[model samples]
Target: MTSTDKYIEMKVPAFILTGLLCGLLLQPVAAQTGPAHNRPNIILIMSDDMGYSDLGCYGSEISTPNLDSLAMTGLRYTRFHNMGHCCPSRAALMTGLYPHQTGLGWMTGTNFHLPGFTDELNEHCVTIAEVLKTAGYATLMAGKWHLSHNIHAGGPQHDWPLQRGFEKFYGILTGAGNYYDPASLCRDNTLITPLNDPEYHPQHFYFTNAITDNAVRFMQERPKDKPFFMYVAYTTAHWPMQAPEEAIEKYKGKYDAGWDVLRRQRFEREKALGVIDKDATLSPSDTHPWAEEKDKAAMARRMETYAAMITIMDQGIGKIVDELKKEGIFDNTVIVFLQDNGGNAEGTGFGGPEGETRPVVPKNAAALKPLGKDEVQYAINPPVTRDGKRVMQGKNVMAGPADTYLAYLKPWGNLSNTPFRKYKNFVYEGGVATPLIIHWPDGIKAERGAVRTQSGHEIDLMPTIAQLAGAKYPSVYKGNEITPVSGISLIPTFEDKPLPPERAIYWSHQANRAMLMGKWKIVSGGILNGPYGKWKTYVSLPWQLYDMENDRSEMRDLSAEHPDIVKKMAAMWDKWAHSTNVYPMPWKEVKPPLRPDYMSTPWEYPDF
Candidate 1:
């Protein structure tokens, strides 16, 4: 374990402690398994549908002082990759394996029933919670737990957080939804609507605050003798952009300058902050000019809502930090913050308010009856509000209200992922790249605010936590043969030792592929279909290569000049795809299991 694990270790010898003292120390100490070891408490916080440069530390104009403070004294990683989307990213992060190995190559909603595409987390893989809990860490999870396929109340709960090793769980079963009256919202194993949840009744029921509050409650009531591990997954800044009106008002007129100017501004700030290469050129964008926009006011208002969502999350992070400090565990707690994926460019309610399921409502409808305390909210996108207001969306309908549902759209997403090329679900830097900030004052051997240029991936998290807790990763768990971890511990980086080069990093989501080997990177995203004939698939696309040392933004394609290198990397990617159960993708043969339809259309950029 790094320098921080000593905080919670109870190593008082029986011979040394007198009669009554022995009982007091050993009573709870016996709860933990394994040898006496220093195990730092870990808090993993993840934001949904955010961008690489969205944090103030990462050069955004948004107010994120809490996250900025963490970055100020923490170690920042410049070349970390997340899986292009939430499902696979979370899978890789939790299991220390590629997504396909966890039977989550696709999303939880899709049950291809194939090797790589099972509906829920498979038996072969163990979660970070399961591993840490075995070593006596009290595991608590707050926020989205979208790893299970059967989210319906009466459906099977075999794969929910409680079964997966979390001692306490308070969050949604499905992914993104309304913050005020979220669907699939639950406490522990029982599903309940926010309006009637008996245990928690804040002045106002906001999801972000609720998530952090429950986490704080867990910490407060936790057995102080044992170390703890928490996963705080916040669904902020995702589609159906909603926040407290006052929070949204904080960023009013923030984006009146539009995406082009905003993107450029963030680029300059990132360079100045040393997060990006000072000499790196900002990647170009396809956003409309601010002056010529027909709905400049609406776009600005939408961005304000998005910024507010992030700002609120930042404030929640501050609350989490404050609690840690109050509990006197701040120095020994490892606080990690990263986004699930880059900014989403889905065309959610982009055009009009006519998109609601119940398009028309009585102008002044009677108030809807409140559900029973134990009744569950089943729909992620409900037809009406808890009080009978019809849920509406569009350019005319303002965002940041309970009755409104919409995303900020692509132009703002372009600004969110400034100096990088695409949005979520693609393998380009903009799609998969996210800022990773880690704070462990007692354990970090590197200088404060140090930036590491070495490349890392979500898979690295599992092994890193394993080393921190000194927990042994199982070879065979519950009779199922477990897959070996594909990641190495990241602790070495925190201790000032640079990671050796030459390990290949692989990624494939919806046929968008990338492989990074040393300074060279090969990516192919032109087609959703894997390369046909040669890659043994029905689709084809040429591989584009880049020298990452120079073109971190992926602006320069060196494929034609380095065909040999491209061919070699493509061959490696093909072999990996086959071995990792990425072959026989369900898209070609198996019909996709009915998945919840959430967005209108995915934002597709030019294919040049």
Candidate 2:
């Protein structure tokens, strides 16, 4: 029978939900042979700032055998996208609601006007944890938790993972920090010490390793009969790109060619591998002319460190997979891997708004120089004491003495974003588009190695997981009412069904707003600074449109030629924005602007 027909035949009536568990438990052994609600265990793995071509399966030359192994046994997605930043993308992924609906319409730093001065997850939404946990799955979270920081302030409320529906939580609370001595590490709601495991030889202090260790522990200790939902988020490959000397040494000379050459090569390789369209145009360089010079050695060294970080993270993933195999649960687990956002260009030397906070290690005076970036460069040799002891200084080189601190320079960062036009903070594809991989050994019907063209977004993940587990999301969770999920399931793609065209995908973070309908996209150069300040908070406009299907690089603007289409799409987009609680202007604007807020801005560079 067809899936819909089967659903109609098997769906329990509203009256049955209350006694469902009792009925299920009382069923005879022979009658319980079928799927227990199609409820397979769910494992979601997220990487940080990973590039489009950073995996072997995606055409990278880096050592990503583990990821490649997963691709060999499952399905790969080529056109999936995120909202383009961390908190926003994560909000969409977890709650299945648009970022605006979750009150994190922009990155935490955007300062978009909200009820409080904090940038925390709103109480109006439901998390995947709350839904799945209620459905009888044990939910656990590990890695970076940027949902809320004020939770630790001992205020009116706390917003850590436990408070948000997760049964177990561990990881950093903020956006960025030192990998070794991160500023914010928590168990439930209390602070903890850094990675000071003397038992582990040579003091191998790395967040990637630590997070993975926690992942394995959780799985090994989980009840075999109870299904699980694990969110394994890793902070590797973001900023503060530090790696072991041996790992960095492997790619020491790999990026000798400047970003221009590297980008074209990676794009061509990705096309050949079917990771992206063969005709997809590469986005143009967004850095200044001075930043383009070929510092082959330095550039290669920087990418080497970056590559090392990814490699290490992959190794950790392998361990987790191995543990599942040991428990004989590998075949039934559904694994989804993705990135929070695109590669970050805010180098280790970058600071403040341009650069997020990174950790600093103490160093001796001789080992110190002007702090270049916020983190350490893997290539730079660590300072050694007169006897030969390696300095254990933290990041943020300029703030302290030797053996006390260390930081990376900015040049390495220029290489991290590589071919992408903009850095982590912008609204460009470089900052938004990310790698998404899905693997299901026994559930998915698609060929093991097939790569589908259907477009997938962060919002789609929730609905997809819900459908897979046959879990019902409630209208209210944790005493707060919730908006229904906005995404459709991807099971259709895996089932080989015809995919639908892009209907309407709108974006707005700190006035960096954009809208995509079918092949056309509209973007403004700036946020919240438009003409006459109508939508006065988002005063940037002069709607530029790009046929994404043909102009994936977003080079040509057809707004003037297709004025009719632009107006129609613009109206539809504005309607969506308003419905989702987006401010007509920046949250800080004193006066509200006209509806639809389409006004031209005075300053704009190419590709906003």
- How many backbone collisions does model 1 have? 2
Itemize residue pairs with steric clashes in candidate 1: 5-38, 532-539
Candidate 2 lDDT (Cα, 0 to 1): 0.64
Alpha-carbon TM-score of each model against the true structure: 0.88, 0.79
Q: Model 2, residue 45: what's the lDDT?
A: 91
* Deviation from truth (RMSD, Å), model 1: 10.2
Q: Tens digit of lDDT per residue, candidate 1, span 314-408?
A: 99999999999997889889999888888888877764443333232334333234445566777666657777667776665678888777888
lDDT of every model, 2 decimals: 0.80, 0.64
lDDT of 1: 0.80
lDDT of candidate 2 over 180-233, digit per residue (tens): 555466665654544322222225667778888887888877776678999988
Cα lDDT, model 1, residue 253: 78
